[model samples]
Target: MAKPGSSGDEQLPSNEERGCEGIRSRLPLTTLELFFVSVIFGMFSITLLCIYITMPSVDQKFLKIPRTVEELRTLTEYVSKYTDSYKPQVLAGFCVTYIFMQTFMIPGTIVMSLLAGSLFGIAEGAALVIFTATAGASSCYFLSKLIGRPLAMWLWPDKLRFFTREVAKRRDYLFNYMLFLRVTPTLPNTFINVCSPIVGVPYLTFLVATMLGLLPATFVTVRAGVALNTLRSFNELYDVKTVGALFVIGFVSIMPAIMSKFQSQDSDRSHSS
Candidate 1:
């Protein structure tokens, strides 16, 4: 039996009410958002597709871990030939080509950095490497932001999973973490640049971290460049000794936080007094 004026139903929302609720419930998406997202992801797709079609042997031919010193030497020499002159035309051409090399996942970046050192001297070489690496990294970050998570994951499956997990734990010290990633050999820095955006790292954080984080590696490669002939293998760029030195630097990088912690503790005690 129904009570008077009681349908005994979940209060059926009016059509108008339902329509409004539907608008509220569903996520709002504008054409502009879709267009921007499409453009971004489309760029990544295009880059990937182009690479896949043209460079099917990519992982083997190019990205295969360069284990031997001869491979590194051969590569440095090839690039060095083009860098024979310090003319503006050659420099511009090198920048443009290197930018593409980095953005498109082409290999030999370290050799390229080393070449800069051999040609430009230590200070200028380091500056060039840091500048170029940052620019290239920023380009990848923007592309990932546009492509969103899906494409980023597709392109860098294993690396993204590890990076996302790590970034989550150190969200508070993002700059330090970014520095660690760039300074150490754990993550290929170019990979980090592209994936960070997909994992939601901010642009400023990426920029500053990139600019500062790449310094040590740049210095090491540049120093090695001073004696480029001695560097037979790519590993020579940053061997165990260099890695140990960098870890010490990473430890020093965390010192400011230790000091800040002590300062806060002292302030807390004073306030209790």
Candidate 2:
């Protein structure tokens, strides 16, 4: 029985304070949503661990700093020794590592891609890279759509604006535009993966573009891996000629959209005249 305006009443939080508490406590992802994401992420980790434990001679240093050429070579050698007996585990470990990096937007996928090429040969490696990359990108897309808007807004406000406008402008040719993004180093694949949904790109477009778009780059990285023994520096992976060729391919992918816009303008000019 509190009295009106008594000292006891003064100690109680006001409506405004209660409202502020509610706002502060609210989470972007509800508990259930977070739990679901955690479970999926955990499954990947568990799968990797199971593969590791079953391997007869697990290199504890496997996949440690894949970006380093020496470490990559060592990892390749370590895995090569057991390929005949542990091929499934090797492939599983690679997929888990690659997908985990992609799902959480971690770096070092480049190293994994290179390792794939070096260990598995070019064709198989490229297929694996493309498949895992697409899977990871799709996972990120849905996760971001569910609970990543605020983080994306916070991390990439300006880039978000540019991407949004570009996506809008290229709505008819969205797949080609996405292909351009994937093939070129224009916007990072991670950024595109997490933000594409936020910018209104369809999942199918993202999937198709990612699968086809990654082929050229995957071919290059895997080919570089085939020669991993001779590579002194990681820079050798993407030399001037390789980069120029990629840019050329990227430009060609988007050229149709550009040509369409130009033809549209030409029609408008003729009509005005």
Candidate 3:
């Protein structure tokens, strides 16, 4: 039994509060809409479009990073001989191309990683791959944010839903999940990129997760790169030894998560009792 005045008071909002709520709802729609429109109309979008148009004109197939041990061996020799000549530009082009493919969710990142190793050798290849991949993933994050969720949904429907749900439910342990994804080699790199932003994964988390998450697989592929000519099939990359190691790594990566879940259940039971 409340007084009439109390009922009236509860229903009323202060002038400032009502105004703020109105601004909030409209801002995401109005302001964000304009932001996306700007990107679509602006120089960046135009340049990207132009790049896409001109891209097909280039020798894109030849542009692929090499894969195979013998290819790497020969590439290293060539680089060694021409270190003063073709090193910087070649590496720069490699980085740019790799980043472009990844940012756009192009399907050849695996070959790119192998190419780095095949062309640059283990240490240098891994470094280049990691750097370019991180940059590309970051670019995707911005692109997704700029375009908004609808475009992301169109680009990656199933992944967007799965990632969004996983992130919402296990936000605190997101790093754990990211680690699992990275180690298991389940999803491709581009799938993770296009879908991550739609889920609202924080930029710092995405950056750190991607940077760390991509390393082992990159290394594995890069190592395979050092043997490209010797290998006939991509399957040779994970012939038994590598797969076994990957599983062990995956297990180690997720053990902490299992421990955390168990601890939470124990705490809940204690509280109830």
Candidate 4:
């Protein structure tokens, strides 16, 4: 008795179908969005260039991709030889590259962090890594919130569900959960940055949690830069021991949440009784 042009499933779109359609329609950036993204990137690049030019270092050939230890070693040695004269330019270059990568969700920031250690030593390198990582995350968060949500949703549908659920569950202790995610590497930072806005995490909470959570991993990676000469491969950077330490840190960060959950259960039991 159905209409000739209609099927049982064709009455109206389900929520799931609507979501899929929304994602498909939203994935592409609008003309105004593209213009904004390009303009921001251009301005950021220009600012970095101005900072570099004002510095004593006259060379800007310091930026290159190093795929192997030999290339990295050579690059490190060259930078070290002129650290006194090129320090400002090198610092500016690293910041620009890191922010650019984070904003655009590009890979290879690990290489840049490693280079930071090789060129600037431990303390300075770790600080640089943390600062740039946090700043870049902030940039990505705002960008995704405004114009990149569809792409983020499409790229990380499953992780997006998990993030949204966890964020909702931990309304009071959200920062701890964020720190846990950051420390354990359960999720990629880029995905977190992009998906967070869509999932309803507040910008301030994301910023604070990112700054706090990235410290241990940043230290490990930046510290590895101190030993870049001995490192055989990028895989070797996160050996079992390092991963164990990160897990431990992650566990500690979430302890408050764990305790709160127990307390909530206790209160619920009391109320039920």
Candidate 5:
């Protein structure tokens, strides 16, 4: 029953086999990966619970995460009442909550930054935001290092490949490139945080870039928080002018790298000639 020019044992896969393979490919993680995720989630939960238990008594309704300007104002008003008496508790809770959101790639950190401004003014608020953002980004980087390859590949195969290739081309100028990314909105921070370690970006470079690169944006958000009572919308925080300024800063950060790249090319041409 062997077909001409075919081995007797050779056969096309059945439809069921093909379907199973497709299903496996579509799965985002394996059992072990899920286990790792659960462990990290559990640790974060415990830390948050501890922070909550130590906090002073307050109406539970006012203790939710703020998603909008109005909601942020409400929570800020309520929390401000206690900051004087519970300064340490307030700072601890805020830092923990901010870090929690960042570590898990959650949104609403903008609102948290606003809250920092509302509570601590520009100087302290910017410092707090930068510190917590770096810590959170670092946490995400390490977590991704452990179990992010599959998830990143599944979610962003093209982006992952592109980032890896770009990083490869700029190993000598890695810090400048990274700082540019952080300063500009060229890529999502969450994507950068998760993919950096996967692409072999060292922790020091990631750490320093995150701290310094976040400064300008952090100052803008925190300053807006100072005028929280007059603030209308999130869009007001980042207009065209602000965005252009950020881009300019980002460009300046990478200028040295660009100049070096050009110099290297010229040197290569001279040698070839």
Candidate 6:
């Protein structure tokens, strides 16, 4: 046995210490990465500024990010008036805003989806939401590829590990696994957007999964937007039935992976026999 003060008795670094060390080791690269992120933010800001400058004059009071049902209704009323006259401008602004929110992992996209439905009706709104959401998710995936490692490690170490392990186990069926994640509440979309690249999910897989898997949920929200005036609360958006439907969709998405796993198990058992 080692003596109490011997080097052999020294404990290995705890997870927290190791994490800090890893972060410190990447400090220089992290600084450069963050500079790039800031540059991207600046470019988006300028684009939004240009869109705003070109947009037709409207009451500034109605020009706010709707955080509540009442706010959404009010903005919907005012923006609808301008949408018809300035459809292209309105669409551009909406897409830019939605994409910016997603790329930065900002919240309130549900509100944006509702607004889309309110302005564009169900079919167009769903399509718009899907396109912008996919674009945003894609943007985030690439951004994460640049600087996501330390941030993911810092913000969600345990979740990152779990995601990485799951991803490794389902490499053969990665598309299905990713689709399931997008369809279900198993992981938050924002989290998925930020950590997907960090966990080694490919851009093509991420893009397709996001576009298709988000359809069901996006449709629900957009449909609700058409009747935004009637919504008493956000809780009404994802009631039990809706949540169950989403889960069913999620299960369907993963069915292929599940079948493959069972088939492999049976094959192994047969070989053993």
What are the C-alpha RMSDs, in order, of all predicted structures? 12.5, 10.7, 10.4, 7.0, 8.4, 6.8
- 2 versus 4: better TM-score goes to: 4
lDDT accuracy of residue 69 in candidate 4: 67
Query: lDDT values of the candidates?
Result: 0.65, 0.80, 0.65, 0.79, 0.84, 0.85
Off by over 4 Å in 2: 1-36, 271-273
Rank all candidate structures by their TM-score, best first, as comma-separated numbers: 6, 5, 4, 2, 3, 1
> For candidate 4, which ten residues in a row score worst on lDDT?
1-10
Q: Pick the candidate with the highest TM-score.
A: 6
In candidate 3, what are the lDDT values of residues 58-134, reduced to their tens digit?
34343334564454455455544533455665676667677777666666677777777877789998999999989
Question: What's the count of clashing pairs in each model shown?
Answer: 2, 0, 8, 0, 0, 0
Q: Which digits, one per residue and each the tens of the lDDT, describe model 5 over residues 28-145?
A: 6789989888898888889877877887676888767776789888998899998898898889888888888887889888899999999999999999999899999999999988
Q: Residue 192 of candidate 2: its Cα lDDT?
A: 96
Provide the lDDT at 227 for model 2: 88
Which lDDT value does model 6 have at 104? Answer: 92
Tens digit of lDDT per residue, candidate 4, span 185-248? 8999998998777666778889999999999988888888999878888888889999999999
Question: Which parts of model 3 are misplaced by more than 4 Å?
Answer: 1-84, 239-241
Instruction: Choose 4 or 6, whichever is better by lDDT.
Output: 6
What does candidate 1's lDDT look like per residue over 1-273, in tens digits?
112233312112132234444444543445766687567557655654554454223233543323455665555555455455434544654465556567656676777777678767899889888888888788777755654344444454455556666666566677777777676667777678677775657789889978987899888888887777786667566678889988888767766655766898899999999
Clashing pairs in 3: 68-227, 68-228, 68-229, 69-226, 69-227, 69-228, 69-229, 70-229
**Model 2, residue 28: displacement in angstroms?**
7.0
Least well predicted 10-residue stretch by lDDT in candidate 1: 7-16
TM-score of 5: 0.88
Instruction: List candidate 1 segments past 4 Å from native.
Output: 1-86, 155-159, 258-273
